[model samples]
Target: MDKMRVSGDRFVNERGEQVIFNGINLVEKDPANDMITPGGDRLYEQLATHGFNLIRFGIYWNKVEPAPGQIDMAYLGRVAAQIQLAARHELYVFLDMHQDLYAAKWGDGAPDWAVQDDGLAFNRSGLWSDSYFISPGLHHAQDHFWANDPASDGVGLTDHYLHAWQAIAKYFLEADNVIGFDLMNEPFPGSQAQEIVQAVLGYAGQRFQVTPDQLMAMWLDDTAKQKLLAQLNEGDTYSAVLQAMTPAVQAFETQTLNPFYEKMAAGLHDLLNGKALFLESSVFANIGVPSALTFTADNSLVYAPHAYDLVVDTNHFESYSTARLDHSLKVIRATQEKAGVPVVLGEWGAYFNQPETKAISEFHIQHVEANQWSQTYWSYYPEFFSSPTAAVLDRPYPQAINGDLRRYRYDPATQQFELAFKTLPGTSRIFVPHLATVELSQLAAQGMRADKRALPGGTGGVLFITADREQEVVLHLQIG
Candidate 1:
């Protein structure tokens, strides 16, 4: 459970081995259950058994500070207890200050005492995420938060948020396995989102030879919306729309989001010595818009973006397109290049129980592997192992590399895992799902010896390989 640090677009452990985290999200937005998701110990045990080494653990600001100036130790204790459970099972975790529409009343974020909605009506719309576009209450509250509006006790909201993070950090100062803090989850641009939407619609209107108003009408119609999403299945078509909205999106990110992050990170940077700050782009970026996010603090930072298609959070899961998702990754990659940070996709794969869930998960995993980016899938539940996605989650991966990883890929269909790296003096670890039947080829004859130890649950095990000679080497494993 050594600390993980950002090392030139890669996560490296205390032993200096490059680490790639393959994991799932553990989040609970419901307040009735005290904002804690019920998984107990078995949940983490299953995640570890499935070869997951990371958890994008969600913690709400509402739960952190239910009232301004009143930090909740009980809530922090509960969250810490879960992190301990994850650590007990050898899982690394990063805390995501999860929010949806900005406040606990709308989604799960700021407390009720902190929400300054200005008496605006909350218009519940088509989907849960639709409120981000249609609810004035949400926008108003978010605007105040970004503006650092004074709360009932007269302290600014953003200031309170920074304080909340510091409190959380102090609480977990000794929690060695708590790797980092995802500053915020899916940060929306308050009321400026309308301008971004207009930019997209304006570009789409001209492309379709219709007015923005007319396009809005079509978007509200279910069948027409599905057809519109289908049109975006073409990568070029989706890229064009994303490019059109880039200016507006960039303005909000560079002007508003970047400053907000700077302030928060500056306040918390001293507390996070070895832990990286996970930065998520604007919520609009989830659908493929490029971000202009940049951090000025000279601390470890990760380009943590959430990639999803327009079909997410809707009943139109069948309309999900890899072309669109591929384009989304393209945009996120551009942002990552600009930031020059390691990427850990904080959220993806929310296609719940779709007939294509397995295919969709596999497609996303392949791209993630190709890019060599770490990721935490959207979520985990008690019965998550029974889902089609669970199998895809257990695919082989390099848990930690002793040297620079040239490339790695796992073909589930063939049960073949291949890894190429510049060998160092120490052992490199790989997680093989079916370790007992795993057979090493080529490398075993090339002065490399693999020590396989079955993990606790016996479903998977780690292959620790040490090379006799220090040079570039490729190891292939047949795990079927």
Candidate 2:
């Protein structure tokens, strides 16, 4: 397959065929481990067998540059070997410079030397994300990094980051099946951390009509923080709270996060010319907040955002609520449409062990299908292909289309798949995995006919169809 480029809310290949990316996030993540192993090759094969066509591969800064001014060729070679392995399986890769709370000392991404905390407390508040709200040391380190404050060696953090990115780009610029870089994982605003937390609390309180004194109590009292944490732990959506905080968070994204992205784009100008730059919004946007970031003229830009309900991490999937899901989809789609860029749901479905996991996964997949959007599920670790979640995650879909796709659906119970699209000169193909027999005799279309062919190595089959120019086509297939 040729390289993909963004074209008006869709991704098109060099041949102008619309391409939809369906894949998973693959990351060894630990710097002490090899970048790619024989196990990784097996995993890639499993992904291909499950009909995945791409991978949002994680590459950490701590691994690539263990120290200041040093580029680890061994690490780069491992990454390259993995890229080659992905190519062999016909899977596209987008390197994600993955990070959590900034450095390896706290979470991941930056090298230990780059962390510039001022001896502040690094306590955890039980929840992994609460550190962002409570850790002064984390806040200080992030603030310094964002401000590009000088390290012990006097080099600015952003400058070092730029160098790291440049080195990565130089290594992968001409590599096969390597799409581009996901500049940053989830950008957290660090300046005025306490004030920002207070502001959000105040906003949520006001929405709940709490008195000023009560709001102040929530901000100042540890008991109140515990109460709030209890609510979150109990699977409270806190919809009113999140809604109230949306505007303030969006403002932060506009004033702080977007500028950071702009800087990264400017720094990577030469290296990312024809490659897709996958951009993610602030962490708050995962809960239905609007994104104010836009890259209007940069056709290589892709709005790659993560999605999760507030109840995420509670081990019980929030019941499938269309109203809740629709709100998030609407907000994100509005942002993408406003920016005139295609969207790829970068990280979702971390609820692997949740009781409602399959339902939630199906809900997200349904939305992706309806929106004609591309997606990479949050992870492919510990290998859960035979788990209940796999029933929804591992399914068939149209991989490439010759023209605009109208809609598609797959009913797990019936083992029936349907797709609708407007026709072009080229052919359209659907990936059907784990099917011993596929019946396309009932396939219905206005101007297209379908034929079933065995996939490479006969792991599965693909239903190939050719459509007349300007004709609308629909296909149906049953698996037994």
Candidate 3:
């Protein structure tokens, strides 16, 4: 129940109760801003005032290390400051090494040195393929990832990645303010099912001798990478190839994913035991198999599935559908059950309002609410900060604060607003974001339980309060 600890099982609060609530996703479009990259303390504090005590924070891997073996201390310092800010706000921080489509250019993942040239020269301005507006490098890596022969170092990249994480962990070893590391954000396993299977096989054969789909009860970080590398080539014989691939794949499953959890947890105890750690498995249900993994302990550990309706639907594997979300639950529930951790739907939302999505979302909300687990929508954003088209509330973000943007679009070219906002309403602070439509008080009525209240500002603002039953919060809205 202690909030300081998070294992392979549950996210228990200091009271030893499993924690659940609506939270914020904090990543800045403008790195120059004081929050996120430059000065995030203000941003953190702002989010706190708006009824958010949990935050999904993102950092690009390349920003930390533009070159292999070289880590930017200044960048790490910036991140540590953000971590401190979260603590000050009494918010839970899930520091995410986020990437989209993959590559330093795409958003943030591998350093420039990690770019793999697999002959994928296709370019895309805004399209979702290998080429890029800046360079073909980002596109090239994306191609290989989907082409199935990902040059993830298979060994080298993973090693550098782990080491980079270790360096970051060292700085925040004593910070009890943050929650856990989300490891890698979204990993694509492309079109090669056989290779995917083989990668796991190789992982098992090399590291814990795990059988395919077996629990890697004992995983050793020291030698796992080497074992994986040894098996990447397999052998001239196809059987040898299969055997090698098994351990490689299994090794990746356990090591690439879980070791991050293990290190963060172990470091907290050994180096900074008071801290908590949770694993955000690769992209949720990208494949039918969920990538969620576990650390040693079974308490306060959450295996998050970043689900999109379309991803779960798997037909377009392209369109988003909440109704199809159960497909994700079914694929991933097994792992979470085995690890004995709550299944955290790290991200979920509808691109458009669909009854099926609503039903599926309700099911998910009920599941999380029934068990008191927490899940967050895909994002939180403002319109004026960027192009109105890019706002979390404007187009695609599954906003929880306010909804029905078609009627809310303040302008024609832009449907979204600007800068994730929080305001101090009158006597009672009330918060209604531009996109959030879910009524927390109403949800409570439906048996979906969470610490929620209707803001005093009739439509938009929130009163911030600490975790105390005696705390009285009220907000007053100012109508235009």
Candidate 4:
């Protein structure tokens, strides 16, 4: 409604403290266009009430410019309206210009024009999975996203997309609560991991003539196998054993992902003028993970990674449990620590089979504590309501994103949200286990029975808190 505050890099307070910046994903819009409808307003309020502070949201290029050079005003209005609503609810925003395999025509639901079509036949190898699309030539091509492909829509296309982002940023960059802008969502340079790497590396000052991308013009190359081999010492047995991944890994870091960010960081600093968040990512869900990026500067650079254990990173092994996921978060935190950049998780969620969402919540909460970081959860779906967001966005609807508050967001197996609240300052119990769905009423009942105190917010007094095995269940009691 009114004006919002702008950001100038640093986000931590004078206290030098880091608190939980719980957020949700906000996606699920028209595949044919790039905008949020009035219908998103109600969800905005619902999200705020449920306690989400930061939101990682997206607007595919297809939606922004359905046809070349043609900007959509209605779509801009829709996006502007969404920002207003988020502002109303005090939700910090990260405007994401998203895409997948070039465009919706490639099957990701983005607008039609973003896809380059350019006679590059449908790889059809892997739709959303990793093993399908990646080829040696693609990996090689990914190694060089800038120079070799000046007009290459894959890399150059972002320049055009930035225009749309600038338009959106112009409207909300001044907003107090609006945080940053995500350049793209799950950027898949298609099977050209090597090519993507080559392009990026060349920009970073390395020169390569063969151009790995030209090698995988067909797409499905299965290069991760060789990429893994490169990780072994030159004379290592694995080189003889299964050297499928050595060069692939080499190109991924030196050429593709690194150079992509270098230009991106530069572009944002130049075009956006350090206005919004320059959040960086290693790869989409299925690509390899670099230890760190080349451009690890300050708060303006939100170093992020979409961490998924069984689903994306590795094959869907039997290790689809909470413990493995926790370990995965730790690894990501370690990478963030090494980079010396503010971190934000762009995407992380459980498979549909995980009956309860306790694991995912615990993973997030533990990560915040471990890194003392702030993050924008994977999705904030306003459409499919259920299909897009992670598993934790159900019942009691987690609407409040407070670092000082104790409330767990419950995303029902059926896509509803239930948020329950409890406190620990005034009650007898001090170690209230921080969890979701643990009974606040039981503690309230106990506090009432114990005559703990006469508090204003609730009848009972504050209590202590501790962790429960299941993340959502915190154990607590009343204050004296």
Model number with the top lDDT: 1
List residue ranges in candidate 3 displaced over 4 A. 1-3, 29-46, 118-155, 190-269, 282-295, 298-301, 311-320, 350-364, 383-480
Q: For candidate 3, lDDT tens digit of each residue in 1-480?
A: 124455344554454433444564666545456236443566555555444556777877777766767788898887777777677766677677777656654555666666675554534543242223234455456444333342334545555666677677677666665666666665543323245544644655545456744422112122443333333323223234334434434445564445545544554444434544456654424333445455455354557666554233222222333334455555566666677765556666523333334334445554544344556555555421232212222121112222111111122133322212221221111233431453445424432233424433223343221221322222222212
Which has the higher TM-score value, candidate number 2 or candidate number 4? 2
lDDT of 2: 0.77
Quote each prediction's TM-score. Answer: 0.97, 0.90, 0.57, 0.62
lDDT of each: 0.85, 0.77, 0.47, 0.46
Residue 143 deviation, candidate 4, in Å? 8.0
Error of 3 at 268 (Å): 8.3
Can you write out model 2's per-residue Cα lDDT over 1-480, one digit (the tens) per residue? 578778888888877888888988886655456644346667777778778898999988888888988999888988888888888888999999988888888888889989988989776755577677778888889889888898777899888898899899888888758877899988887755565566666766665578655765564455564455445332234555556566667777877777888888888889864788899998778867778786857688899988876455543355434455567777888887788888889988776655667776888888888888889887765746766566686678988888878889988889888888887886887888865576555654333567776645435666788765678766676765
Pitting candidate 1 against candidate 2, the one with the higher lDDT is 1
Which candidate has the highest TM-score of all? 1
Displacement of residue 370 (Cα, Å) in model 1 is: 1.5
Which residues of candidate 4, in runs, are more than 4 Å off?
1-10, 13-19, 32-38, 109-114, 125-127, 130-158, 189-247, 270-276, 284-288, 296-298, 312-319, 322-327, 350-357, 380-480
Give candidate 1's error at residue 373 in angstroms: 0.7
| Candidate 4 per-residue lDDT over residues 1-480, each given as its tens digit | 222212222244222212234566666556443435335656765554444556776666666766656677777777777777777766677777765544465444345544434443444454254432543333333323233343334445546555556566666645656666777665544454544444433432222232445433322333543332233223333222212433454454556556766656655564443344544554532222444355445446666667664333333323334544554466566666676666667776633333344455555555553454555655443343344233233222222121233443322343222223343222222111122324456645533322222222222222333322222333233212
lDDT of 1 by residue, 133-224 (tens): 88888889889999998999889999999999999998998788898999999998888889988988899999888999989888877788
